[model samples]
Target: MNIRADIFSRLSRTDAHLFYLPPCPTPPFHSPPPQKRSPLHSRDKSKEKNVLITGTSLNGIGFESARVIAKHANLVIMTGHNSDRLNLAADTIKRELPSANIRPLILDLSSLDAVRKAAGEVNAFPEPLHVLIHNAAAPIGPFKLTVDNLESQVATDHICPFLFTKLVAPKILSARTEHYTPRVIFVSSIGHGIGTGVNFDTLGRPDPTRYVPMEAYYQAKSANVLTAIELSKRSKGQINAYSLHPGGIYTNIMNPASAPKEAVEGLHKLGLLEADGTPRKDATLKTMGQGAATTLVAAFDPRLDDKSGAYLNDCVAANELIGPPSSDPANAERLWNLTEQIIGETFTF
Candidate 1:
């Protein structure tokens, strides 16, 4: 049996096209050709757009996405918990694109109080936000709880982003005009297909017995998709919301070699890992540029304006790739309500 095809077939609940099967190519898929003048300063200053992205660490896709966004946006707010790393990422982008306007902000997504404080800072930015991308994810490890008393993975990956989104929603809405509509993107993963649906019973619980690191990780990723779906429905065309898998890239966060033994063996069987257990060198994986393309597309593609709430892979819409549980509107609503209840806040459109 072809292990890669077999695995993907099972991962995609439907018989439709497989996620990451088309093989994301290496090239700038969404960014335009460089202009004689910087796109940031070449346009009217008042009309220039602003973008905010989380998890701009040096080794992840978030850094790559922020680098690209800085080329076109008036202000690119790059965020992370480490002030030094955040500043380094912003400096690196500025070095590459001398005209890039970058702001380094500290944001820790694990603590509800910290997220609220950071959102307040973001909401106070001089210009309204045109795009918000929740690209941060928790590293998989042993079961742990956050200061907020929730499971570490779900808190960092889903709940904090939800709170931040609700708090900064006004800034996003304020950017909307007759010609321009703001967008929000959640950087989900193909791992989102791991489970049938969000397990509300165990979600946010700190019981170590109930926690399997990778399963919890996938459940949180699925929450990203559900959140996007619900946010779009509630926004009522005022803002665009999307979720995407940034292809199978060999980033620090996705090194199968360092994953669980079963995960490594599975990747080996699927030809995604070499006999020695390192990632295979082929089209099966994407470069940083290719990996970040779908996120860029979800953020700025005018063609997707009407496709809000859709899940994307390889720079195109791929709702068929997600399982029915992740796509069900009722599940989205359920997760939304539970998240609100847990966070002790209510949001209404």
Candidate 2:
């Protein structure tokens, strides 16, 4: 079926769909937020708000989210791992908007402990978090493991945001204008299909010899989408969570800056490109400003109210069943459980 038809089918059966779609071999195509709803709530519809963009130091989706949010919102907190890059990004934003309220913080999401701690600090920030954009992620690198021995992909992508959102939920909710609701947006990828289906039992297992880095990365991304849906169901009526595929881009996401030429060529064979290679929606190479467009729209767009569990691509919803079946059924709960166990006492619900 076509992309739109597939999404319609999935939407038709949302009550029965429980898990995210898993990995696949070929036939590339497509697939398919919100906060509280008040009676005729226009108070939350204003574009001006406080926003947080994660994983932007490397200048991909988060960086783009920052730029786009700046166009309508006044304050943005950019979080990443590298201090120099964080400062440069902040400076670049300042140079462009001059009046932008951009704060750069170096927070590595690789460690579950660190994510919990950082969430506490951010939740306490004076400014309300109207939009929390979770964008930072790393492919579970071959041969790398966290102190807790979990895969880096799950640690950064699933557990980290899980805890971060848990910690900041109330703060985001408080930002809701009388009629508006707070939102949490995740920059997911089409690559997430590689996770097979979420493995309920071995979510964080780490062993490079037994892993395909990209597929593992895809698993973590799927966890992201599932978790978002689960959160929407659990939040009762507070914060909303969403996962979106930001389309294809040729950013440093693959560590292309360090990869050998052959590796780059291999991806090119698969149709993924970088910088000059990205398809331009309007005459430019999908600027960081533009790459973040959907994120900003999802964050502040009034249309998304009560759609707290939506999975998106290019700003529209997607239906995963048209693509494939998820690898596991207990994945969402299992991943959420493992994440809570990792955060332990440090994590806040």
Score every model by TM-score. 0.83, 0.76
Q: How many backbone clashes does candidate 1 have?
A: 0
Cα displacement (Å) at residue 33, model 1: 18
**Local error of candidate 1 at residue 86 (angstroms):** 0.9
Write candidate 1's Cα lDDT for 166-209 as tens digits.
99999999999998889999999887887766888877566788
Candidate 2 per-residue lDDT, tens place, 65-84, comes to: 67656655768888887788
Off by over 4 Å in 2: 1-46, 259-269, 273-290, 320-330, 345-349
Instruction: List clash counts for every candidate, in order.
Output: 0, 13
What is each predicted model's overall lDDT from 0 to 1? 0.79, 0.62
